[model samples]
Target: MIEFTNWDILRNLLLAARWTIALSLTAFIGGTIVGLLLTAMRLSGRRPLQWLVRGYVELFQGTPLLMQLFLVFFGLSLLGFDISAWAAAAFALTFFTSAFLTEIWRGCIDTLPRGQWEASRCLGLNFKQTLSRVILPQAVRVALAPTVGFSVQVVKGTALASIIGFVELTKAGTMLNNATFEPFKIFAMVALIYFALCYPLSLASQRLEKKFNGSR
Candidate 1:
């Protein structure tokens, strides 16, 4: 029944929050790039490319993220990669984020008016030009809210990284709880910290969605 002091627990949580921030940003950025590639492939006219992209999306989305992390951490080690937990966690999260994002963005893209594509083609735009200049620009407005909202999920998902020994906020909380025997205090503070990180992003996403919808 050790008592937990506010300042001590807050400082430790903040330090752990740094790793959470790092991992979240890493996964989001990496996954965004990969997701864009996946989106393009899914939209591509090639049958094989579409199938491949679909398979990739389904595989990651269908599997539990915990299992994916285990596969990356333990499975990769078995394959002789010698990867650290940090790398493994990041890799696993990137793929997990990419699959979800691709699906999200595909929905956005699909929401565009079919006339937009027809009009772009009428202007002599190739597939690449049509997507880059016409479809994507409109789709982006539709995509922004969900994309920002998903960022909160990315931040929260860093907790799973703790299981793989990534030393993020949850891991730090666990360590502190173990030392001080104050699980309630440690976890409450951790939840508060996560709320602080995620709430603003959620608000911003809502605002953006409202503004964009109004503009439309």
Candidate 2:
């Protein structure tokens, strides 16, 4: 058995944490882009477009992330496309995140008074122009707190990537536990590291909501 000091274990876990952070950021950014497109389509007022976006959201949201990971990681290979664990994880999480985010953003837009849309029309703006100029501006503010809040979920979600052999924090911790036979200590540190990462974002989310609400 390889003996490791506490510091040595922590140092290794910290290194592995970078992959978790990188994966979370990648998923969040990719999700944001895709979510924005889905949101736009959802709000397009065309039955077909809206229905298509709805179906996309439902498919991802209804399925498990682990299942999605398996499909992307292995299923793609069946189609003869070479896929790595990291790529599969990123793709799965991105789709999953996008589904939830699109819904969150859409709900925010829906909360606006219809008068906003009517006023924009009075200003001779088209549907696209009104959305870009008026609706989205106000909606974005209400969306910000929740979006920031949702990122904590994204961070936590990265743990599932380990199932597909992505060498992230949880994976590293498991590997360390196998080597050191210290599941209790190693996993405690793993939990601590996750708290360290997530707690700040949770606080920030609350603060944003407070600050924005106070101003309004």
TM-score of each: 0.96, 0.98
Candidate 2 weakest ten by summed lDDT: 207-216
lDDT of 2 by residue, 1-216 (tens): 878999999999999999999999999999999999999888888999999999998998888888988999999999999999999999999999999999999899998999999988898999999989899988988999999999999999999999999999999999999999999999999999999999999999999898887364
Ten residues in a row with the worst lDDT in model 1?
Answer: 1-10
What does candidate 2 score on TM? 0.98
lDDT tens digits, residue span 48-75, model 1: 9999989999999899899999999999
Which portions of model 1 miss their true places by more than 4 Å? Answer: 1-4, 214-216
Q: Would you give me the overall lDDT of model 2?
A: 0.94
Error of 1 at 168 (Å): 0.4
Question: How close to the true structure is residue 3 of candidate 2, measured as C-alpha lDDT?
Answer: 80
> Could you tell me the lDDT of residue 156 within candidate 1?
90
